[model samples]
Each structure stands twice: as structure tokens, then as C-alpha cells.
Target: MTQVNTFQLNSSKDEAQKAAFQLSAPQDDCAVMFASPHSGRHYPDEFQSLLRVPLMDLRRVEDAFIDQMISPVSELGIGTLSAVFARSYVDLNRSETELDSRMFSDGAPTPAGERSPRVEAGLGCIPRIAASGQDIHVRKLSRDEAEARLQEAYRPYHRALTNWLNLIKRRCGRSVLIDCHSMPSLVAGRRIRTDIIIGTRHGASCDEGLARTVENHFLALGYKVARNIPYAGGYCTQHHGRPLEDRHALQIEINRRLYMDEDTVRLKPGFYKLQSDMKALGLSIMNWAEGTRMLNSQRT
Candidate 1:
């Protein structure tokens, strides 16, 4: 399961299929799925022309090679989904309604709730800021253009995820989504010593035992682990994490300093070691799935 594969942004001039995401589907017994939403590197030529900031700035926001880090894990009977389109084009983590009206010429979708802090910060579903901490758009976007990004990328991703999870629930009586991400080593110029941050929306998103299972793996590997300090799960976790309904989600954030150089967006010597450890972790998750399966059978 400890296989390595990189889905590079602008990976080639080969004119690859303009798919929004790359999916390594599970063969059977998909009680678990590991997702890397922000790891996509492909930037559409159309999207590139609309941005004001340099590509490197948007690169800063990526989870980098997280899809590669977990792609190998799919072999262990787990499905994997990685966005091939960069988050700068459309963020998969935010709700579709989380659009900023200020970025559009006519108007963006009217949000259901009061405006959120993310939208105000220019980090909406259709983002205004590249990871470089600068505005991403050179000109105001048309509402139709914004809607197309959602129609093309956002809706499809969530639909696939829903179809997969629902099928797993029907087959296995439960499903768990491990929404994976990588965090910057330094926040506000201060280095973050904690290597992993697990979020379960303060115990509401997932069962405590499931969250603990993920945490213990990183801890055993000698990585510093924290819970819900900076991140307490995003939309994927909140929307799907429902232990009462036999669905669960937990967001895992790995400090990028452990395995990559943030400035260069390149892998470091530490990557191999981390990769091996993650392979072991994936196996443990497969075991956990079997354990839950057995427990469900007994309950029935």
C-alpha cells in the first residue's frame, strides 16, 4: 500500500483529459475512503488567464503531494479521490453556496446564511485569494463563469463522493471518510511543532474511538499530534460526519514541514519515511473496517 504517485499540476503538455479529479476506485468492501481534496496540480489554461497572482502563490495553498501520499493506500480495499484541478480554480472543501458576491460583475449566488468569515476573507468556494495571500482575480467574474466552475468541478466531485459513500453504506452498513490535508509548517511566521491535527468538530462529527484510531497511528510513529486547535473539520466533515447514521468523517492535517519544503514545494528526505508510515496506517484502517464490520454483524 505504500506506493508513490504524483499527480502534478501542469503535469504535462500532453493534453490530458480535462477531468476535474483523479479517482482510484475501490474494488470491494469500501467501508472506508481516503480523500485528498487540495492536492490537485492541474490548472486549466482558462483558469490561469483569469488569475492575477503568480502560480507559485496558488501553489502555496495546495496540499502538495497528499494524493500521491495516499494513492497507494487504495490497494488495501479503500477508495481514493484526488482533485486534479487546483483549488485556486475551485475549492472542494467549501460549501457550494459559500460564494462571495463581491468577486462577480452582475452577482454571485445569494448565500443561504449570513455571509461567512471564509467568504469575507476571499477564500470562498470560488476563491479570490491565491495561497500567496493576494487577490487571485484580475477582473470581476461573470455569474455564468462562476456557475460553470461549480457545474463542471464542484458538483461532480461531491456527486461521485456521495454515490460511493452511499453504495458503501448499503453494502457494509457504514462508511467512513478520511478527509486528508497538509498544513503549512509555519503559521504567521511561527513554526508549528505539532505534526498532525485531527478534527472531528469537537466530538460531534465522528465517534471518539474512530478519531482516536487515527491519532494513535501518528503518535506511535513519533509525530506530535493535536486535536481541533487550528482546524476542526471543513464542510466535507460537517456535512457527512454523522455517527448516528453510521457515517463518519474526520479531517487529518499533516504539518508539511515533516515531509516537504514549503518554500520550494518539493519533497524532502523525510517523505520516504512518512510514506512508509502512512502505508502502515492505511492497513490499520482496513483492519478497523473489518472490526466494525464484525461488530455490526454481531449487533444484527
Candidate 2:
């Protein structure tokens, strides 16, 4: 067994009661919604003890500080929803149907539908492993228990996200959802790795123009931007993104090495600079969302 970082055999469901996601700087009728699905670090003392690995080791799979990087999005009058529970608890960016059987001690949970490759790869709504393939529990979970986790953590997060988008669409003619995330510095890329990878589900989720708009924003910053390469998008982009209906979605994957100490999970000297840059990035999207075209088309 991996060394337990914090051991608590008694973690309450109350931990799950904590809002899976948070909304900050809410503008009731904003055209754009920024979401940080991975930047949650509120590890309860009991939950921490249950981890079969060191706390630092468990964090290897986390998108540390992703919420903070995109936090400025709300200040620009855009709505930002961020998850507060670590991805190890429940992954909001994954499809509800993506549940794994291997992690369940009993048979797979009931109501399995639309199983995805992500589920097979161990990254599911109730993930069997963290983003880095770390096993979350020392023992397998019962199917009933798995379902409980999904119902408690995964379901409500999406509910909030969906409600938010609908509200924005009611106000604006349409809504744009930017699913924010961070990636490890290294991957098995065919060529040179990129600093940023923008996934729009091969443009099926968002209009090409809108996708290009975001790509150009990062490009203008002189950051290496790649489109639909190693990461083309995940469950949130695939499930929520609807270009034809005018609801656009894009997934932004920032390289973690850019701002954090991956080994120790600490903020690097570059953290503030990166946050500053992201603020500019967020502001640009806000300005674009508040443009005359979108504002004039709002459902008045």
C-alpha cells in the first residue's frame, strides 16, 4: 500500500455536501461562463487520512490552483463556476455515464449508459484514478457506494452548471462555456510538446470563429497554442457543447509547469505572473462576450 498521507477511516458524506462547484463574481446575464473543473483542494482531514498515498503524491493528479488562475474571469462580469472538491473525489468534467467497473468491489453500478473511452481509461465521473492514473482508494468500492458518490458529487455539479448556462442563454442569445483545466508538462506527443492545448471537440462543440477567437487570444500572448491535438476535449465539452444551437464550448488545457512546482504542489514564483496573464485572457473573453453583437442579440 502507498504510504497514507492523512488517515481517516471515517470521512463523512457531509464532505460531499460541500458545494461541488462555486460561482464567483456572478453577472446574472453574462454571455460567457468560465468553469474550473479541476482546481479543487479542500481535502477534509478525514478524507485526507483515507488516501492510500502521501498527500503530495495524491496531488500529482490535481490541477493545482486552476481556479485561482481563472478566478479573474468573474471580475470581468462573466460567471465563473469552480469545483471545490478535488478531482479525486468526483470529476465534474466527465460524463455522468462514465463510471468504471474495475474500481467497484461488486459488479459495476447500475444505470450505466454511453460508456466512454475515458471510463475505460480509468478517468470517469467517479474516477477510479486521478488524472495521473493514481488509484484513489486502497480497496474497491461497492456498486451501490459508487452510485452514491455519483449522485452526491457528480450529479449536482452538472445540475448547477446546466442551470447557469440556461440562465445565461435566457439573457444572452446564446452562451459560451470555457471548460478550464491544466495538463502535465510532458505527454507522449508525436512532436514538440505545447504550452497550451485548446480542445473544441474538433469544432463540433463551438463555432469555428469562436474557437479561433480563443486560440487567437492565447496566440497573441506569444504562448504556443495547439488546437485539437493530443487533447481535443473531454466529457464536458462533448456533452454540453452545442454549436448549432449557439451554445459554444471549448476546453483550455494549460501546462502546469508554467506556474506551479509540480513535485511539491507549491506555488512557484511565476504563479502571480501566470495569474496576471490569465486575467488579461479572461478580460478579453468578457469583452468579446459583451460585444455589440452578443449584447444586441440578447433575448430582451
The local distance difference test score of each candidate is: 0.83, 0.73
Cα error, candidate 2, residue 36 (Å)? 0.8
Taking the tens digit of each residue's C-alpha lDDT, what string does model 1 give over 1-300?
322233455645655456677777775666888888888888777777877898888888899988888877776778888787788888999998888887889888554522799988888898888766788989999988988888877888888888888888888888889999999988888889999999999998988878888899999989999999999999999998999998989999999988998988999988888777777887887777779779878998
- Candidate 2: which stretches are off by over 4 Å? 1-16, 44-50, 113-115, 130-134, 188-192, 292-300
Tell me, what's the RMSD of every candidate? 2.7, 6.1
- State the weakest 10-residue window (summed lDDT) of model 1: 1-10
